[model samples]
Target: MTTGQALVAVRDGTFLPGPCFMPCVDALLYRFRLVPRSILVMGPVGAPLLPP
Candidate 1:
């Protein structure tokens, strides 16, 4: 799969149980203007985008 597709999969997988969580993911993705290649899932700021 493409990097963007994989990111979408990971995001959906994590937030699928409670779709409400998708807004945050979506907002982040929107702000970045593209799906992230990798995510850093820790820290007060939540998952940060990795280098492409």
Candidate 2:
């Protein structure tokens, strides 16, 4: 994939149970048209990952 534009992963809100909080993520899937130059998590911005 080629670099087209900057993209950020976002979610509307955290998960919740029937009557309580239950934060969770079904999965961490990165679906993009172009290859991202960098992917950031809890660490520094613009962190690099393995080349495709």
Candidate 3:
């Protein structure tokens, strides 16, 4: 999806539209790891994706 679409998704889910590190992919995955908050990152389909 485009940035606008992403922004809409973020807003719809009440998520922080932090920034898209990966522009090639549209899917954004959020998960809690090192902090007490959800961290957004690119999926494995994109570069430097998070491990499963």
Candidate 4:
């Protein structure tokens, strides 16, 4: 998802945005140790991401 989309997601959720580290850790867990085993790095929170 795009950064905008992620922002929306985080906003929609009960929690407010904090540090990027938390999401990075979550992504890592799903990347190598969880079901589906997939992760997408969306240019860090509050940063710019060029459309591909």
Candidate 5:
């Protein structure tokens, strides 16, 4: 999926269900106009690190 599609998936709450509550994804997935490799993490602004 691309960013827009991913956004829609998220809005529809159909992205995924997980034990982690949220998903950990690659940083590159959100790059504009790029094909999505994973879900984009958004929240807790200024987080020092992303999931490994």
Candidate 6:
């Protein structure tokens, strides 16, 4: 999906949008892993993993 569409999904609490292609795929992969939580960052550079 396009960034805008993904953003809408996130805003509507349906799904999260990653900032880039790789991260988006990663998110989809991990999503089925049953992780209790996740994070999504927004910026011109695209979504990147935040420092823990």
Number of the top-ranking candidate, with TM-score as the measure? 1
How would you order the candidates by TM-score, starting with the best? Answer: 1, 4, 6, 3, 5, 2
Query: What is the lDDT for 45 in model 3?
Result: 36
How far residue 45's Cα lies from its native spot in candidate 3, in Å, is: 45
lDDT, residue 47, candidate 3: 39
Worst-scoring 10-residue span by lDDT in model 2: 18-27
Query: In model 5, how many backbone clashes occur?
Result: 0
Best by lDDT: 1
Error of 4 at 13 (Å): 23
Q: When superposed on Cα atoms, how far off is each prediction in RMSD?
A: 13.3, 15.6, 11.7, 9.4, 12.5, 11.6
Q: What would the per-residue lDDT of candidate 6 be over residues 1-52, giving only the tens digit for each residue?
A: 6999888767656333333454666566567864333433233244235432
List model 3 lDDT by residue over 1-52, tens digit each: 5999988887766533323533222332223233322222323335346333
Candidate 3's TM-score reads: 0.26
How high is each candidate's TM-score? 0.31, 0.12, 0.26, 0.28, 0.24, 0.26
lDDT per prediction? 0.60, 0.26, 0.42, 0.57, 0.47, 0.50
For model 2, residues 2-43, the per-residue Cα lDDT tens digits are 232222112113222311331122112224323232432322
The pairs that clash in candidate 1 are none
Error of 3 at 33 (Å): 30
lDDT against true structure, model 6? 0.50
lDDT of 1 by residue, 1-52 (tens): 6999999998778756544666587668757867543442342245345433
Query: Comparing 2 and 5 by TM-score, which wins?
Result: 5
For residue 32, model 1's alpha carbon misses the true position, in angstroms, by 0.6
Q: Write the per-residue lDDT of candidate 4 for residues 1-52, one digit (tens) a residue.
A: 5999989887657344434556676677777766443334443543444332
Full candidate order by lDDT, most accurate first: 1, 4, 6, 5, 3, 2
